[model samples]
Target: MTGSDAAGRLDDDDFPAYTMGRAAELIGTTPAFLRALGEARLIEPLRSVGGHRRYSRYQLRIAARARDLVDEGMAIEAACKIVILQDQLAEAQRINEEMRGTASQESDLPPG
Candidate 1:
């Protein structure tokens, strides 16, 4: 790939750039922890050509949040569920804001 192409990928939060080990190290966790998160269906890592798990920055953030919940004495299963619900709620709120903005804009238009 061209240098520009490689540089562009640096800005991609979803790009599977970090290996499993690196991801775990960056998040101060273990490989098994990431595997457990996957098992719990919390975050699904992409597979490299050699069939190894590759995580993105976004996935790492989610994993970090799960790790925090687990550290707070929450069960792994419950932590995963809470993270999933949190994601869903955040998405719903974003959509709601967008819809409200659109409706407000429509209301400001002249009656036709």
Candidate 2:
């Protein structure tokens, strides 16, 4: 791949650029914690050719949020559930906002 192609991947949140160890370090958590997250079906990391797990920035963000909840004494399963619900709610809100914008634009046009 070209230099620009690789550079663009740096801006891609879904790119699995971090190894398990690095991901754990970046999120200030342990590998076991990450493994537990995987067990909870929170986030699944992509496996490398050699069978090592690799994580993306997006996964790290979710993991970090789960870690926060866990730190607050929440159960792992419950924390994962809450995070999933939060993500769904955010997506729904975004869609609603977009629909509202389209409706408002349509209203500005002449009635036909």
Candidate 3:
């Protein structure tokens, strides 16, 4: 990849730019914690060609939330479930709002 290609990836939140150790350090957690999150199916890191785990900014954010809940005495599995539910709820709400907006626009049109 060229310099421009690498530079642009820095701004891509989904780019798997961080190794497992770096990801753990950035989040102020241990590799074991991140592994647990992966085991729980909360955040699946991409694997490099050599089979090493590579984390994206988006996965790190999810890991951070899981860490927060775990620090508050919640079990890893429970935290994962909550995070999954929260994300699902947010997406559902966004879709509902979009549908509502479309329905209102349709209502505002004259009957055929």
Candidate 4:
């Protein structure tokens, strides 16, 4: 990729820019914790060409939430499930809002 492209990717939350170690350190967690999250199907870090795991900012946010739940006495598996459900709920809510907006706009139009 070009230098400009690489620079822009740094701002992309979904870009796997952080290495495993850096990701763990940034979140104040351990590499093993990240591995456990991976095993639990929580966050799937991308694999680099050399086989190292790379995490995105978005994944780190999810990891941080999972870690918070764990700190609150939730099991890792349960935390993962909760995070998944939470994500689904957020998406559903967003879609519902969009549909509501569209329906309101349609209602404003005169019937054919």
lDDT of each: 0.98, 0.97, 0.97, 0.97
TM for every model, in the order presented, reads 0.95, 0.95, 0.96, 0.96
- Global lDDT of model 3: 0.97
Name the better of 1 and 3 by TM-score. 3
Give the runs in model 3 whose Cα sits over 4 Å from its true position: none
lDDT (10s digit) by residue, model 2, range 1-112: 9999999999999999999999999999999999999999999999999999999999999999999999999999999999999999999999999999999999999988
The residue-by-residue lDDT of candidate 3 on 43-106, one tens digit each, is 9999999999999999999999999999999999999999999999999999999999999999
What would you estimate as the lDDT of candidate 1?
0.98
Model 4 error, position 36 (Å): 0.6
lDDT of 1 by residue, 9-110 (tens): 999999999999999999999999999999999999999989999999999999999999999999999999999999999999999999999999999999
Model 4 regions lying over 4 Å from their true place: none
How high is the lDDT of residue 103 in model 3? 100
Which regions of candidate 2 fall more than 4 Å away from where they truly are?
none
Better of 2 and 4 by TM-score: 4
